[model samples]
Target: MTAFSAIHEEHESDKEDFTPGVEPQPTWCPGCGDFAVLKALKGAMPELGRSPEEVMLVTGIGCSGKLSSYFESYGYHSIHGRALPVARASKLANPGLEVIAAGGDGDGYGIGGNHFMHTARENHDMTYIVFNNEIFGLTKGQTSPTSPKGHKSKTQPSGSAKDPVRPLTLSLASGASYIARTAATNPRQAQEIIAEAVEHDGFAHVDFLTQCPTWNKDAKEYVPYTDVQDEYDFDRTDRREAADMMYEAETKLHEGEVLTGRFYRDEQRPSYGQEKRSTGEMPEDHLAERYFEDDPEFERVADHLIDRHK
Candidate 1:
């Protein structure tokens, strides 16, 4: 059988026992933004009609990192600022799997900042969800990469001096195929954005503005809610317009004036999987056969490559 055929058969066999069910109760604090994000994810997963076995959820260190344990799917709770590499490797290893990389702002945009930029440029087929709560909740409320200036936190005891990172603008600038922003409080909108991200063929990222009541009680002036309506001129889809909006939003702290929606999408770029296939590589089953039939020297090389690297 072809490698693709064998992998398909394996997936089919695994799906026999797969069933959609409620996710485990989250371990986040009450009113945590992660809770709403988790709920929106659960609501979106079933709509995709994908079996749990076909899905792989990879998360990073932080309150959002705990998501792997709460979902009923293949999961990996990776180290801090490392979810992107882990998720990228997972997708490359098993291209058939529907991979979703998730983490908090601290884990994704802070220390893991480099991975975010390259991953967007790579245009891999995966959905990245960043719950941007502004502060590092898991580390006991330290100022995160997206923490705005003057926002006090454990790390920034006297309020942050530097401006916060604008993730949406960065993603757009980094050539992300799909980019979006959403608020955790708006569950319906969050779910829709996530669903769209999942359906997008290339690297898709959703920056979710989540609330951190524990650390950001005073930073409520910047948080977005479903009920609040602020005047935003979304009249243009040009890149310059998007960049301007990002700059304006970051500079001016207007209450109830957050923009939440798909900011950019480019479907022209080929996904990593498509590129690999186009290069005439054998399908999954053939690759597996090659691995199993290869001599011990090749086996040793494979072992060394996997063990010594990454």
Candidate 2:
């Protein structure tokens, strides 16, 4: 197993434990779906038996990025569309930390879109929470990548002609080991889904359909939803079946029928860290803990360059 911190002492952790000591109180506009995500995440942490010290939350720029501040865990407020890369580095350095990367749809699926696809492709052992509000909430509601076709906005006053990105399908095609869609409207399912994603060993992507009443007034409130696992017959482990279900869900999203639940999971696949360790590439101990080691590769390389300059 990957050793995160040798000195990290385990203790009983509760929901309140994840509440930051000194940070902004969740300032999302009233009725903003971001509240539900925070709540579900808070609830999921205690369920995982994880302490704030054991978890790390990395977020990108945007309203959703505020999660790092509100969360009590070790946090990183990375730049716009860059939470994933920062999170990836942290996880690679210390895999024992429960790494969670969160960002708004625009921050995640727009400029950071390339990072999202590749992170999933590598099957990184981390939970990625994309607040799919379908628009950029912080930037005054512009037409985001996930905005439906013909969607009107300050950026697209004539209604956007660009087709919305099918995040779940894109996630699947990118090779995420676990993929699911949840919404702020369904807290119970959201909590359960988040918890499951945390427990999953490989890349877990949760497309959270959050509402933005302050903006995107035309966006669906994501109410009266149906959980595919509870109501539909599909194999989560079967790629073809999962793909079919995701297609329907992505289609019905625009048609006003909200479908949410686990769409795909492949537990058989090994996580990036695991693969590296198995191949003798990843050191037994975390790289972060070796900074003081004598003649570490980095120091050796620096010494080589210095001698050449001399």
Candidate 3:
């Protein structure tokens, strides 16, 4: 298990373990791909034997933000493009929660791009799933960072002149230790990829391709997809090979050929948490537990900080 693994009682888990007691029905439109993400995520938890209490899901503002509400876990529905910072802070504090940050393309690649890049560069111990529907589904179908060049939208009535962001390539260049892409159309693969990402020790970035039927009418349904693992042979650990594959995959997507699968993985690199601990910068004891310890030393340190600040 990685540094992020929680010390929970080992037992069998089921998909239903992630379902809330109240179980509010999903409001996503019929045939919406976000539904597939939710279903696949639920299916993945049991494979890792993770209970709801061991996980933390943080989401940014968007239709995808509703994920925090639906999933039964310690969840935070954060403001637009801010889920990463919150997830990062939580993981650093506890170092035991299985933190997962989520957001739509606009929420992540557009407004949260800087945070995403730096988090990956630092090799944060968490999984980040970006729902790449190309266009912003919420806020009335505006053009997003991942929107295809020449894509017509409410914000770009004449057609967007900017090229789509290559997420896989960006993740690799930004120093993510694990990188993968999966589409909602392939639920089994999506579930498998999510499980792998969660288990990875370093920054794991999964660019999830979802279709927005209500807004992105011209976008492909992400059907007839090619799983790179099954179809192509390459060394995922080799930066050059991974870069080549990611570039090809990014190019093919806008050209109407959908390719998805793991592109890069480097397990040897230490996660940010591990580095902090090794340097004695971060306390070995989980910070979240310190508040309940009632130790005199802890109070003395707290009082010293408060007095210094005053």
**What TM-score does model 3 achieve against the real structure?**
0.95
lDDT of 3 by residue, 106-209 (tens): 99998999999999999999999999999899897999999999999888999999999999999999999999999999999999999999999989999999
lDDT of 3: 0.92
**Model 3, poorest ten-residue lDDT window?**
291-300
lDDT of 2 by residue, 44-125 (tens): 9989888887888999999999998999988999999999999998998888789999999999889999999999999999
In candidate 1, what residue range of length 10 has the lowest lDDT sum?
A: 10-19
Q: What is the TM-score of each predicted model, taking all chains together? A: 0.82, 0.93, 0.95
lDDT of 3 at 204: 97
TM-score of 2: 0.93
lDDT of each: 0.75, 0.92, 0.92
Return model 1's CA RMSD, one decimal.
5.1
Model 3 Cα shift for residue 273 (angstroms): 0.5
Give lDDT: candidate 2, residue 104: 93
Can you write out model 1's per-residue Cα lDDT over 1-310, one digit (the tens) per residue? Answer: 3333333333222222233355456768887788777777777766766656667899998888888777777889898889999998888777877899999998888889999999998898999999887788877888888877787777778988998788878988887888877887678888888988998899999988788788777555234443212455553346776677766654543344666666667777898777877886524432334555435223455787888887
